[model samples]
Target: MSLKIKKDLKKIRKYIDKIDIQLLNLISQRARCAKKVAKIKISKDPKTKFYSPDREAQVLRNIIRNNKGPLSNEEISRLFREIMSACLALEFPIKVAYMGPVGTFTQKAVIKHFGKSVISIPVKDVFNTIENKKYNYGVVPLENSTEGIVNNTLDSFIYSKLKICGEVILPIHQNLMIGKKNINKNIEKIYSHQQSFAQCRNWLNNNYPIAKRILVSSNAEASKIVKTESKSAAIAGDIAASYYSLKIIAKNIEDRINNYTRFLILSDKDVGPTGDDKTLLMLSIKNKIGSFYLLIEPFYRYKIEILRIINRPAPETNGVWNYIFFIEIKGHRKSKLLEKILKEVDMRGAEIKILGSYPEQLIRENKSNEE
Candidate 1:
């Protein structure tokens, strides 16, 4: 508003513009160097083993150690992730598939973990995505804080050949949405995917007991139904609301304030540690006494922390007599303890499959009072 303020603002704008230009130049130079390196590596090795975790980790450490800026370490890490992802794309594009019809929670989770630049292919079912190799990587929801485990997703892993390459936990915020034109009425019907409905069961039962609840294939599909039907409201996430241009009638309808969903990243190739890691495995033992206990005792003996275990009927056998056990543990296959456990399991002659080991999603501690 004043002459001095206006002059100061103009100076700041010029400085910011200069910084932007420097960043652009830096990124362009990096891209060109990466291209040359890729060409040389391809020609020399001919194996096309482009992904190097050690190299990536060194890059991140160098950036963090030398950082002297207003930007925090986390912000710098994210920026480099995008920059490196772009460089990797120049060498070869990464393919990712997730459960969907766009606006579904799985799509949001994939974007959160991989950023917006990834090639995200949507599939009808989680199994189909993994079994058919529809994409290089697949994401499937495994469990939720409020809903326990997604049985179908777990069961799919039992039969699928793909291994767990990584995992990400996404905080879920559910909303009661209605189309713009349908905002006036007390909606007679509500539509949502089964999981969505289950998550908000208590809230819906107490608030809208008389309304007819219809199950749909996905939250995005339910949002579409609501947009087409004036008398229907949909339970979905912010993405669905934005996609359908619906009004949020209510927010955070899940029973728990800290509702989150855990997703498994499936791929055929095994991923090693990214510092933090989680390993998944499926084991089948002979139908003899103490066979199951004998299989899992190695983990405990080796001091490995078991995070999850689920039992499913072996698909190969007709009867439920033989079962398969799925285990998620907090260690990498490269670790000495885990390697020992794997060896012990192998020596026992029990059918063991090392699904894969990958980086564990880091969760920021909640500072919100509501949680």
Candidate 2:
């Protein structure tokens, strides 16, 4: 209300307006530069791929390294991701396929990793769309920290020819959504994916003890069901709530505060390694007592760090009780040391298969879109 205060505010506003104009000009210049790069690349090779995971990771890492804080590293990275995504659209439209039906978390992952620029094709089976060349890439869940591996996705990899080019770990947030018909009434029943129900069982027990439970194919499906059923509530995330136009009665109801799901980016093109990379292996060892130890011995000898190890029962149709070991190790398989160790493992009568060697994602660094 003071004249001096009003004068100071006017001066600040003038400076901000000037800076905003300068920023617009700089961003336009960057986009023009991107266009030139794309033109030159296509001229050299007609089949030049637009998405380079390794290069993108390098760029983000470099930005973080050079960042001097006004905005956090993640804030800068997200802004740059949007910038790149826009520039990429100028080159060509990026098409991504995901396991979905409109409002699933996989779609959220698609938007999270690619920004809101790509053409998202949501289908029941992501692989089918990818195989049919309906999209440039596919996104599928690999594993969950709380519920474990997505067997369907892993099984698809068993026979599919797709390569894993990138990885993202998205935190899962379960929310309670109610429809307009019963906006303020207590929910009589609940619907959600089985995993979601399990993840939020404690919260649900405490809040809606008498509500009946109905399992659905996905959290998205639960959201859709709640849209039509007034007495029913859904446990899904932001995407579902927004798509279905539901109100969130509760947020972050998952049992674990740090639940995360790792999703793999599937492409026909193989990606080169980033310095910080992870190689995934699915191998069936010989049915012998010392086979397990012998398979992992090479890692110790080479001083290679093993990130994770998971065992699953192989199909029983072969008339043998076989086990498949899914091992994840730091560094790419292309490294000389890893190559030598893999060769030694083969010599030790262990068959090894490389699922992928991709840049390891810096998890929980970026704020999650969902629980």
Candidate 3:
């Protein structure tokens, strides 16, 4: 290489080395502080019930409020998540379970919301993860922009005692990826998760009308299948493509540009205010007339925007005769107005379960062409 190119390469190497050293120093400082905190926590609370959502929320809010930097609120939130995760690890590594075999959208949401430093435990099913309590938190897909609601996730709420602690909205970008050796040809089969297939229904019908659409267990699974199967392509995210070493045959193949999947973070304990917040509730009403409207009227009167409301059959009954309504409303449990509304809900309902209050969904500005 020329002398100029060589000097530039050396400068890049020096910059990387500086970053590595900085990271090491940061980690060392964090470790020392974590150790001290752990000791203090142990001495104060001998029972080892040291996890405090209220305290954590306060810390996060303070960080965000006091932040004066190029980093946006979302970036600051993510940074603090990792910091908190590391601190928590000092006391005890938090096990977070999410729906995955790894490289799935659920996993992406979990990492995005919790940060990569968190101990992520992938579970096969939603209920299995929630019922185990082996996980401090569980991330599960609740709804998608195109596919509507995930009934299975909603049903788990009725069976498991786990509460919704937070919410995450991950932008869904489905790509038609195939093995590197498998160039573009007469594609015989298209593989994807049932939900992914549904989301891309219009695109599939229009472009690959003759291709046999196969439903796999997940997007990751579809990618895995396509890696070995010739003349077959899979619909998955960029992460899955990287994992399976697949080439993107077609990019952003979803039916809509703004496709997004909403996920719920479940925990045994409720979350507190982080300044910005959202609350999820599961309400069961008496099968009497106008009971549903009566239950929702309080929220309307309070001027709380109801983001979503999905009906799932009460497991107690065999048929769809009895239904449990899952509702997502604005504001936190700590808000004075929301506190009063909760009381009103209690008086107006047969049963009201406060699923937990968590930080509001982070809205990222999309600059990509497809979006």
Highest-scoring model, TM-score: 2
Q: Is candidate 2 or candidate 3 better by lDDT?
A: 2
lDDT of each: 0.80, 0.86, 0.80
What count of clashes does model 1 give? 0
Q: Which residue pairs in candidate 2 collide?
A: 171-371, 172-371, 173-371
Over 287-325, each residue of candidate 3 has an lDDT whose tens digit, in order, gives: 778988888898899899998888877766654477788
Q: Which ranges in model 1 have alpha carbons more than 4 Å from their true place? A: 41-77, 126-134, 183-185, 287-289, 316-320, 364-371
lDDT for position 119 in model 1: 78
TM-score for every candidate vs. truth? Answer: 0.86, 0.95, 0.83
Question: In model 3, what are the clashing residue pairs, if there are any?
Answer: none
Give the winner by TM-score: 1 or 3.
1
What tens-digit string does per-residue lDDT give for candidate 1 at 21-119? 999999999989888888999999875646554356557767888989797766776688788878878876777788879888898777766666677
What is candidate 2's lDDT per residue for 1-371, written digit by digit as tens? 99999999999999999999999999899989889989998999988888888898888888888999998776788888888898888888899999888898899889878888988888878887787787899999988888998888877766677778888888888889898888565688899998899889888889899999998899888888888778889999888999999999888888898888899998887778789998888887768888899989889888999988888887776588988888889998899999999999999888778888888875355335332
Candidate 2 ranges with C-alpha deviation above 4 Å: 366-371
lDDT of 2: 0.86
